[model samples]
Target: MSLRSRTAGAVLALAVPFALAAVPADAAPVPEADPFVWTDLTPTYTATADYQYEPFAVTDGYRPIGRCAQGTGTGEGGAGYHYVNPAHVGSLDPAEPAGLLYETDSNGGRALVGVEWIVRADNAAGAPTLFGQSFQGPANLDGVGSVYTLHAWIWKDNPSGLFAPWNPTVTCP
Candidate 1:
């Protein structure tokens, strides 16, 4: 081989390690803190905000659509629905749920079931993701329109799956 080629190859070999080392060791796509982690750290915060906010109220653009326990995907006694919040279109919190799946108590109080995400961005151009997961459009989940949505069992575990729309573990009151 020519000296020129050998020298070029030698330079690349020496720079490879330096380039690789420049990157952080924990550069993996894993999230630093997810719903479970945040809720564990601040259970009261999650509960308080969820119950007080009443994200699923009729005024919140989240209409009751189904029930999970009896064939629907909503909670046992409570129900879930298709939701959209134009006001919070691009909001996202790595340490908290962008939205909450709620279950009503016997006393008519709201309880936390899981977390939800909904975006009304055009083509989801500004949608957000958490825990290294991306926001999927209606094409992936059950929905229609340019909006995107996702559900995570960050507060409660879902035996069926973590990303399942409903959490079988969260029973209604």
Candidate 2:
């Protein structure tokens, strides 16, 4: 082949992948490694009784199921209070987590610590993943049925790992 033709072919080969990889300006931005950093948890809280009350309006669609204390024999830290939004349960969107985790203090104060995404095993096409992490479980969670769950400890630092099921720093009451 001619030198000019060979050079053009090489250029085209390199350019094709870059062109294909370009993201559209309007495309939803890639999720942050810590998706909850910019997330405002104010709307997720209840209107009365500190963190003990269910949200008066349920604006974000999540309601407090109740606090989950540390397991007696599980040897893992607790997941704290769960504010679950039934509408987003099976969704794979990292931005729309199925549950929000909160830890309460000695004085009945509440703090948003993490987020959870859950998909009932029966409803999932396969195992679901978000933020490049796989969900953990087909096991039965208390109120929720058999499901896959992922926890992101964005607010509370987890020594175990970012997606670990339990955070050593998190506690109930």
Candidate 3:
């Protein structure tokens, strides 16, 4: 074969694998939004050594205030809400431990809270996992079919204000 022909053949061989690896034009593309978007993952927060202002089922020198992945909606007066994953906190105080919570907008952006664990992607069946005071979920638990629920807490010190559920739209993968 001519030198130029041989070189062309070698280049084609090297490029074949990469071309096959490229996303197929016919293949369905993955969604850009995080499936967990608008879905409550978990909550986290901060607290003093005394665990004052915060409470949990366990008192092993840890706080249960962790940050949430996202908010149910613009929480409490247009302030979005974020869910906390208590399992993520483990033995650390949400207040003292930096980034202990996956904070978001809530309570007029004045109040932030977290949850103990993220329910299964489909919430199919599980006791819930707690790694101290935080928890993490797979990028797409249901492997592209998973969905999440954004359960949140609404507090009212006064018993005179009307109450409504806060819901909002979020991206999903």
Candidate 4:
């Protein structure tokens, strides 16, 4: 081999390792645990008769907040109906989500799709994170007030991502 070619090959080998080391370790994609496997939420599935805010019933400490429709824009599918448990709002426990998300079918049936973890902005020391994902906002949520929220599309697959606030496949009546 020529001397020039040998030197070029040696340099390339040394550069490769340094280039790889520059990438952040956290940037690597990490596999996450399924967020939907909760046995403790059994009572929420059956408690649909009691009303806490009228029209919306309080089922196992959760009451229906509202349904959000798909927004106009590329990939801006809106979040579905939110059923919030007031008691769970401030806690960051992954097993105890602050709210449940449901998608309404044409037959007027609701299907469980995801879970939401919320912490009121005013009550938080900083942005709250769970499942390695940061909460989205301090935006004002009607009736619930300003809060930081994160959604995990557990039961349903989201095209956007697992932690995305909106799901394109979800629609409301």
Candidate 5:
């Protein structure tokens, strides 16, 4: 074979085993809902639309299904927070966070977990929608008043349901 063809064949030979072995019978990482720990929990929120979350979070307690209501986690609760704006209503920006999901550590540090999509409810309209699904809010929020939201356990699996308001599987770190 020619030099170009020979070089290509060698490259493919080295890649074949990796391609075939990359997927082991059971090599998937633990579910996001499972107890995964992250390191940094930075604060980042900026509103770019009319729809938005209340600047101040209202209350902290068990949520719709007893799962900690995100930022409302108790003294020893996990610390999940929102950091987005109404302009993000239908944003497709992968890095434009809808919200920051966190699990607080023993030292009181917050570990990043999943992300949430948040939007506001206009007096004249219904909830916002994205990713082929409607945003979750339109329900009354404690700090920012009433709004819509979506929980993408993209980083974790929620036993409470992938899109459930609160993740039943998330635990304090």
Candidate 6:
């Protein structure tokens, strides 16, 4: 065979096995369902952050099922917090990055969507601590299995006061 053809054949031979090895047979990663895409979750409110009792409402001891990526544990509690929004939300402490929580409901009349966010801030004692709240709203899906936009009203609670942060809404394409 010619030199070019011989080199091409050798390259394919090496790549074929590696590509096949990447696909696991039994232990394949399971993709977590996207409530936004699945139409199973409500979609009326995009995402917002406010002190009111709307979506992002502040309540204690409530968590949702989420995933950072495949092959990772479920983010039901605070255990699987490694899953990040690639897009950094604000200039918060790296060690205590902000959290983005999600909840959804499918019923039409009852709006079932809530988002919880946690950031480093001062508690009532005036000490550096973590505070978070849930912004909830009605889930209005545009269409079944259709793409829609998600928005959140995010802010910073520091000594200066509450400030609207960057990239508050998360759009689902």
Among the numbered candidates, top lDDT falls to 4
lDDT (10s digit) by residue, model 5, range 57-155: 112121221223543544322325444333444443443544545555456654444566656566566765544456665776555556676665444
Residue-level lDDT tens digits of model 3 in 36-139: 31121212211311221233323433333322234344443321223233343222332222221212334323232222223445555533322212233432
- Cα lDDT tens digits, model 2, 1-173, are 96544544554454334333443466565443233422332222211112222342156577777557575645577888888788888877655678777787656755667778889999637678766677898867667788899886655666666678888777665
What's the distance in Å from true for residue 60, model 5?
24
Per-residue lDDT of model 1, residues 1-173, tens digit only: 96544544554454334333433575543342233433332432332232333543435444433333322544422224333334444456533333456666567765555556666546525656654566765433233345556665543445544455545555543
Which parts of model 2 are misplaced by more than 4 Å?
1-58, 72-75
My TM-score estimates for the predictions, one after another, are: 0.45, 0.62, 0.22, 0.65, 0.47, 0.18
Q: Model 5 segments beyond 4 Å from truth?
A: 1-79, 83-94
User: Could you list the CA RMSD of all candidates, in the order they appear?
Assistant: 18.1, 16.8, 22.8, 18.3, 14.2, 22.0
Please rank every candidate by TM-score, starting with the best. 4, 2, 5, 1, 3, 6
Candidate 6 residues lying further than 4 Å off, grouped into runs, are 1-83, 89-97, 108-128, 131-173
Preferred candidate (lDDT higher): 2 or 3: 2
Clashing pairs in 2: none
Weakest 10 consecutive residues of candidate 4 by summed lDDT? 45-54
Candidate 5 achieves a global lDDT of: 0.44
- Please give the range of 10 consecutive residues that has the lowest summed lDDT in model 1: 43-52
Full-model lDDT for every candidate: 0.46, 0.62, 0.28, 0.64, 0.44, 0.25
C-alpha positional error of residue 49 in candidate 1 after TM-score superposition, expressed in Å: 3.8
| Cα-based lDDT at residue 64, candidate 4 | 79
After TM-score superposition, the amount by which residue 105's alpha carbon in candidate 6 deviates from its true location, in angstroms, is 0.8
Model 4 per-residue lDDT tens digits across residues 1-173 = 96544544554354334434433576544333222322222222222212212244343577777556465777677678888889888877765678877777666767667778889999637788776678998877767999999886655667676678889888756
